[model samples]
Target: MFSNWNKWSIIVFIIALLIISPILTIFYSAFLGDTSLWPHLFSTVLPRYTLNTLILMIGVGSLSLIFGISTAWVVTRYDFPGKNIFEWALLLPAAVPAYVIAYTYTDLFEYAGPVQNSLRTIFNWEGAQDYWFPNIRSMGGAILVMSSVLYPYIYLMGRSSFLRMPISFYQTGSIYGKNIFLTVALPLSRPAIIAGLALVLMETISDFGTVDYFAIETLTLGVFNVWLGMNSLSGASQISSVLFIIVVILLTLETIGRKNQRYFEKSSGQNISSIIEAEGIRRLIYSFLCFIPILLGFIIPTSVLLNFVLKGFAVINFQEIFSAMFTSLYIAIISSILVISVSILMITVSYFRSNKFQKFLIFISSCGYAFPGTILAVGVIVFVGLLDNFFKFNFNYYTGGIIILLFSYTIRFLAVGNGAIKSGVTKINPNLINVSKIMGFSFIKILRKTIIPLIYTNIFVGVTLVFVDILKELPMTLLLRPFNFETLATYVYQYASDELLEECSLAALMIVIAGIGPVILLNSAIKKTGKIRKSEPLIY
Candidate 1:
């Protein structure tokens, strides 16, 4: 037993260390007495970057909660005209990448866009000083674009929590003549709401493409500006360290909040059908409430992209687009497989064999998901630079290759794979493993025969999620991909960055298309997992 434990311990330790190396490199580089550029950055753009980041976070978080929680509550608590369609249709936006949405919105609302053009023609207005119009490249636009796609995180988690609420609670609220939604549902769903908000906020902070195109001077944009514009990796690392600390603080608050609050209820053996059904005007209102999000999130942007593709069909490059599509698919597949394997191995060993300290290390290793991708990419660059300097080797030879890109993806996305597998792992009976062990089965044999089969559903869920995420990934791929390498993301980014959405519309559409299937599969898996959990007998 001691030998087996040691073997697993060593493996888990190595995996955790590799996962955290880039983050550690960022911190290490930040403190290397790099003060030359700090003064310049502080005096010039740091404050603006910090302010923009805060505003973006606040705006995106607030709007996403509004969109996500409202829609989730309505769907779970009441039966509306299109409640069934809205339940799944609301999730479609999750398939669209934020950058792609940003591009489509820009294409549809910019000064020369079709909407503005039509309005001018109809109203007989002139060029420069036409009627008032909202600029789709401002901070407000960033919030709208981000919230449209990101709200699903909140919706998915919040709806699940609401659905799992014991019917007795609603009955009691009715007896007291209290508003069930405000008095019972909202308070109980706090954890899920916070969890989803945390994801949205983290993704908001990590975003680069949307902010870059909009020219919003957020911290993520500042990280890139410092790295590339000024050629100061240390300064960039310092900024990244600040960003890392900010995320750590946010996550710490979330953890502390969760620890202080707990919701418990006896099962009523009733599903969401027990909730009152909306009728007539109420039903129409509920349907419209859900429709607004779907329209802004998926339909309008998709229509715009489709329009671009239609208009540019004659000039669209099938060869290069297909080539990029194949590349994106290939990398997404390989990286998802590699990430899921590592996540399962690390999470399993941590759960079964590790000490408290080892478990803590494992927890911290997943913190990469909280860092902005551009910052994380910079960390990878710094780590690789150290390796190159120590070994006197050209690390660029590898950094410019697919291997580094995959490693970066693993670092950035390990959390997704880990979270899915860990949730599945917790539901598993430890006795099954102990029984296998008592039969003189090897640890590997136990895992293969028992654990793997039980967690196959979760493994698929994680794989699908990681694959879609990789497909839509932009910053890390843009920074680390090999010369002449073009994923669908980078391919679209080239044209989108230049505001030539018409040319890259087909490629951008393909990214969303690739993700749609996986997104649906993931949502189904989550729903199935929730149902299975609810059906299980409480051991306590």
Candidate 2:
């Protein structure tokens, strides 16, 4: 039967090929690697890398949960002064890349920096050993920096869950003389919080920038160390495979825990959720809590960059920075469009078709984001090498040597798109599709008329996320881009890799500025959708 299936099959095949090729290359490399090295890895670098990665994950995970869930609960439930602004402001950190934040924070908080210098002069201290200060280039610092920017993933998801809850649950808690916030809202939002936590953990595990900057030696760091330091792509792929195993286990546990659980809104009429109003002291505390994250995530890093920009010593070539900014914007926008469109298509098909193989394929495709971008980029390089060789021999043709890097980006970033779209699909009621089908609407018609409009906010969320990810991308772009091609990320990384951050401050600042537009627009769209959903029935 000719249906959307025929059309979708062709698209899905291309996407699946692009998504799976790098992984296949990594697997082949791993299979061919010397097993003798595994024992040495276990005895030497493996334990330290695994322990540090686990510690960082636990630390960042705990902090992000606290910051994300508490702030989400406070803002969604209570009406305090500036609560309206806090709703969107809490999301600002989502715009700042963790690596850029790391660079800015290092400049601001290092011992030779203004704060320490002021302390030394005031306290009459002498040399390096005069007093103790916390190091921003350590594991603890990595956790702090990562949590500051990453918690918004949880916050956005948690708050949406909180706002959707029926008021009757809170009223029932109040009737029983229970703490409504803790007893009613938190429990109801647990699934969402976990989902957000899952995203945070995946991002943390895949993170290379903060760990590399802090010298924390995560699994991702090990992948780079093994590949570059040991000159063994096979060994690097082996390490990446281990990281991938951990992610699969974690995701499996989360899925099992959620198997029998449900979050469907009750169908009873007039189920409006009530907003709690805070008093004087409570209002001040809530507002302060909300501001703390912004202070750490955005204000501090931004202030430091601004300071350096103002300093005559921090020289910047404005024309060079502008060109880099344009390149970054162009690549980020194009890549985001591709990722989001493909994600929406995959998610819609996987959800409605109920085919086990297709579902598994999509799941495997998204796991790409769990691997370090650098490692994945290497896999892409190997795969591309093979493809180019085959093409040159068979078709007497060569790959668009430059364009393949962009394809590699699509492979790496499909997860951000798939995650957002899948979450959107999960939130929708399946009955809507059945109803549409019963009404004689074709699958494509139902998708175009019902699903697309229903999930446009999700598409934007995925777009904004992929855009920022591409903006901050470094190692992958560095290795994969055409010779002489420099996006802002690569431009900044050149100076940053050499620790000449001041020289690249303008490019870094441009990344943040470029991100600002999408961040604001996505936040607005999410909030608008939530408001509309609140008043409407719980129809799919």
Q: Which candidate has the top score in TM-score?
A: 1
Model 1 alpha-carbon drift over 4 Å, by segment: 1-5, 267-273, 393-400, 529-540
User: Residue 441's C-alpha lDDT in candidate 2?
Assistant: 95
TM-scores of the models, in the order given: 0.94, 0.86
State the displacement of the C-alpha of residue 325, model 1, in Å, after optimal TM-score superposition: 1.5
Compose the digit string of candidate 2's lDDT tens values, residues 136-183.
Answer: 898888889999999998898788777677767777898999998788
The 0-to-1 C-alpha lDDT of every candidate, in the order given, reads 0.85, 0.79
Clash-forming residue pairs, model 1: none
TM-score of 2: 0.86
Q: What does candidate 1's lDDT look like per residue over 152-179, in tens digits?
A: 9899878877876766778889999999
Error of 1 at 182 (Å): 1.8
Per-residue lDDT value at 340 in model 1 = 93
